[model samples]
Target: MTRVNHQHSKGPHEMPATGGDRPRTDHGHSHHAPPRSVEDHLRAVTELLGRSPWFGREPVRLPLEQAAGRVLAEDVEAGLDLPPFTNSQMDGYAVRSADTAVPSGLQNQHEQVDATAGNPGAADSTESLTSLRVGPTVPAGHAPDPIEAGQAVPVMTGATLPPGADCVVPVEDARPSGFHAQGATVSVPAGQAPGRFVRPAGDDVVRGTRVLRAGDRLTPLALGTCAALGLGDVLVRPPLRVGILTTGDEVVQPGTPRGPAQIFDSNATILRGVLADAGAEVVAVHHVPDDDDVLRALLAPEAAEAPHPDLWISSGGISEGAFEVVRRVLSGPDVAEFSEFLHVAMQPGGPQGLARVDGVPFVCFPGNPISTWVSWEMFLRPALTAVTGAPSTRTEVRVRSGDEFECLPGRARVVRAHWDGEVLTKVGGYGSHLLAAAVGVNALVILPPGRGTVPSGQDVVVRLLT
Candidate 1:
């Protein structure tokens, strides 16, 4: 078990000391301490996750099929040339360039013979066309017999070029405009280049060339590239193992009967889906009622079973409310070695907490469904990408706002929006409990702290969601 030493001094983000080693539990909200900036809280989360043992664990080997959505741990080099041999790039006839070149006497004569001159003799002339006897047909994936100097072999696309053939003339350029039987004559255009319609060996990728580098995510196209390189497996970083806990007596499992004051739990489902998309494996999920002993027992070292999680994430019970089970249990002196619960200067996800419980990192998010999601996107997602490089980072683009909106003073407004390639329109209200309203949101518009109305057509930064 690795222990992280965090300075417990009263810094800018810390509240006044409560006269003990353990930091005071504000339940993620305290009127005394100023709310930490979004950037500062994000930096803290990044550092916490970056220093853990799970971040430095050895890479694992997985088959190519199973490597999708995983980060590559090492560079992958091509073992052989992509084409491996000279092949025809089109379904055509392969012939030596010299055989297609016009004779010097004929060239000089045809140079002055213009069919556009309206001369019957020039229009009917065949002196510029080169005729060659067609050899054996070369289908794709078949080796071809050598062709003589004046012979043209009918070759399909991707068929290996027959020996002695230096170029291919596409069937569309031939006089017949179609393939001919062996031993039949075909008329081809004169002056064909040596490498026309031919794919040379190593054209796409050369042997020993680095095709994929370390820290690259194995997406669908990436996996296809590995398959094209004849690789059966690849080395990738193991996913971060995570445990989830949702607290609050008012929260009940979905599909079960609920009391008058209870609401169906959506935090657990949301966290599971989001964590899976971010490439983290959820090892366990538990719902802890607003009871300190129940929450404490579940997080105890003895209570943890095999396949222990590298980190724990809990939603609800961290706010300033009276029944904040997570804040009460985790911030206790005997429960956590280091813990801090504070508010961030961001709307919808202001309350947050981070701690080290039994040498494992634990991150606490607010109870609201949108707050939990926004916290993951605003802080945890970026931190994971920075530390591990799996689950590629989101793209932020500055675009014109599609609608006019007001901003709050001293707090960043994270509003869900839809990006239409040109402008960003707000999707749902800014309330954290409007989870159902965020259905079609694909972008997050981040408006910095200010007390004024933003007119339409003003530029705003947006983070695109995958």
Candidate 2:
């Protein structure tokens, strides 16, 4: 077991780990007092870890080259109108209302109104006209002059409306292109509105409007919207630098096996992945012996400089074992009690906690792989997003379970699962050591802490995994 050695006493201004040593069995379980409820313990640590208050956040103007996963810093507005001008809603002929012989011309308002039951265009078709031939074609971008009284212009869908002409008569409504079709007369239909088939400028989004508001997450759809509006870059918050530590005398790395007393270090890799997914750039992942002197030496300023860590995360050494980090932190004459780690009422990942020592946020999680994962997803995720100004939310999606599963009562079980559209199928065995099952799982089916067993076809809220 490790213990902190202090040379001299410091004033109250100094900050140190809290708690005295509590005896533990050789295997490392604790003999301390029964732990408080997980929620209560979490709340206690948060209140103590004001080291979080020392952190600073800055805004950045990122070119498209570095914008992925960054939190947006400001509002983005449309620089110009979408589409830019009034256009055709479909491919058809743009004809003068007066040129066509049902609606009366607006010049004779009274007669026009009388041509039909109070409708406007009734007299134009009935006003009596001979024949009008097709004029020039109007494509999408440019506009042509108004339709003259004796002609019609062919217009493609999305073409800006000419100086005149409103409703479009679909191409099918007109005779086809050859002599058998073109030049043939078709009966006139009565009562077409003036602006019928025209799409007005700024119809989709008007210029100078706030297209995206401040703090909005830049999704692919949102990013596309900005690009369509002509923006090549976005303003967002810079990524945070985090310091990670994995603590355990028995922990080992992957691809290596130890005799009887060792297991691989899954916490470090799991946390790296989690932190990256949460948008943090790890400054250093400290792997130190489970000795307080070694940990303190590794944590000293000389080990890392320049851009200091904005936050730190460590696994294990927090329980009541003689070598418990929490105990060593609190026991030294240089150390001061700040908070305690709690065993929450949750399955597989119960021994999780967060603390603040000396102005740096420290998230202490269990050494067990599944325990660390659950702690990260349940607690640190929301907290990190909030601190970094990310517009991320822990989205809950409804899905049916494909199979029946049972879990410990009074403990929330975070089961791994695959979302197959309509239902979520539980992944391999619900053991904390099941890394394979947790790695590729796309969703987490959370059984309410202590909630009952879920049978097939039952509704469950799945936490999406990215």
Candidate 3:
């Protein structure tokens, strides 16, 4: 197990004290408090979002085409058996197993027995191969007629088996490998077992079987299964409606003119993609300068349009800085219901805040591009999984480290890495600002606090992003 260093931090399950417990600095920012463990902040976010109205809203019926990535609100049962009836699994001759049986002494004989050639007991002869008179052909979708004793019915793949037939001899195994006309004789091997090359009814899925359970995401393949079960639409949990706020005076939208000291805002793009991947619907997005008043007005209830978000997520302006617009506005007694600003014991995403703004839950993250991405992956995505069982939950695996890396003593080190199945290789530098270097990274390698330096080939825990 990969452990997070939490020696000086509180347990992840413990909620931080709100309001008066936080001492305010002269700049209106909360005084630095002991950093909380990564798990601690995650639990808080998960609990808050889980209780929101959007998470518990009634399920909506959506066509399979529109239900991709949505979680099922209820179990899906099959209306009918897959294949629906006993059928032939190959193009062959269907016959009674007893008619193909040969005496033990003749089992190894390579000779053929012609039952219509004056040999009254040819079917039971030890000196000859079993042969049967051919009946009418059975094409797919056609109701086949029953066969009599010493008779063979040609069947196409997926064709329903005739009532009197107990087994099929594939065309390749018949002495004459092609279909025969009515009343023709076809020679087959003896001692063929019943049910050979035959597909029993309900072989794939039985009627009334629970094929999909609640919380199962409607992926392409999953939707195909639903279609096979005769379902045109499914009941799915409503997507989480989210509002995003990106703050900073130095951040400008991409494709707009940029000042010498300002950079393009990547946080918005990053958040939008990840939120969508997590099955959330982005209801609103705004980039606010480091002005508390402007931030306050944007968050005001009446200012937001319909389909308002059930939660608001702001990036930047939550760290300990002089002009932290989000922290300043959301922390004010008049605008906030309950709020806590604290640090989590994880690099690149340590600064974190949880609050309620205008009765809607708010989660605040740090501003750096990589920091924002890491924050979503480490905190918000996991919280969403906990709340709605969304399919965005990442799969974690333990693998050998392909590269050696240093770790801080009291905070977990989250390194961008590429997992090539056999080993996890570091992708970029540990600095949160090295966003460009993070390209091609598919996993996050987490090293617990106090481990210091990990040697190559050592086992480490990794969360797959792809």
- Estimated TM-score per prediction? 0.88, 0.74, 0.87
The C-alpha local distance difference test score for the whole of candidate 3 amounts to: 0.81
| lDDT for each candidate structure | 0.83, 0.64, 0.81
- Give the per-residue lDDT digits (tens) of candidate 2, residues 227-275: 8888889988667777888765566666776546566676788789888
Model 3: per-residue lDDT, tens digit, 420-457?
88868899788787777888999999889876699998
**Winner by lDDT:** 1
**Per-residue lDDT of 56 in model 2:** 64
Q: Which stretches of candidate 1 lie over 4 Å from their true place?
A: 1-31, 103-105, 108-128
Q: Which of the two candidates, 1 or 2, achieves a greater TM-score against the reference?
A: 1
In model 1, where is the ten-residue run with the lowest total lDDT?
Answer: 3-12
lDDT of 2 at 389: 55
Q: Is candidate 2 or candidate 3 better by lDDT?
A: 3
For residues 1-466, could you state the per-residue lDDT of candidate 1 as single tens digits? 6421110111244232222233335433355699899999999998888756586578999999788899999999999898889999999999999988877767754333333233444555443667899899999999999879899899999999998898999986666668999999887878899999999999989999999999999999989989988899999998999999987666788889977767788889999999999889999999987667788788787899468788889897766655667777777768887778888999979889998887788888988888899999999989889988867889998899989877989999899999989878898787787787798999998989999989999998899996
The predictions' CA RMSDs to the true structure, in order, are 7.5, 9.6, 8.0
Q: Give the TM-score of candidate 3.
A: 0.87
Ranking by TM-score: 1, 3, 2
Error of 2 at 38 (Å): 5.5
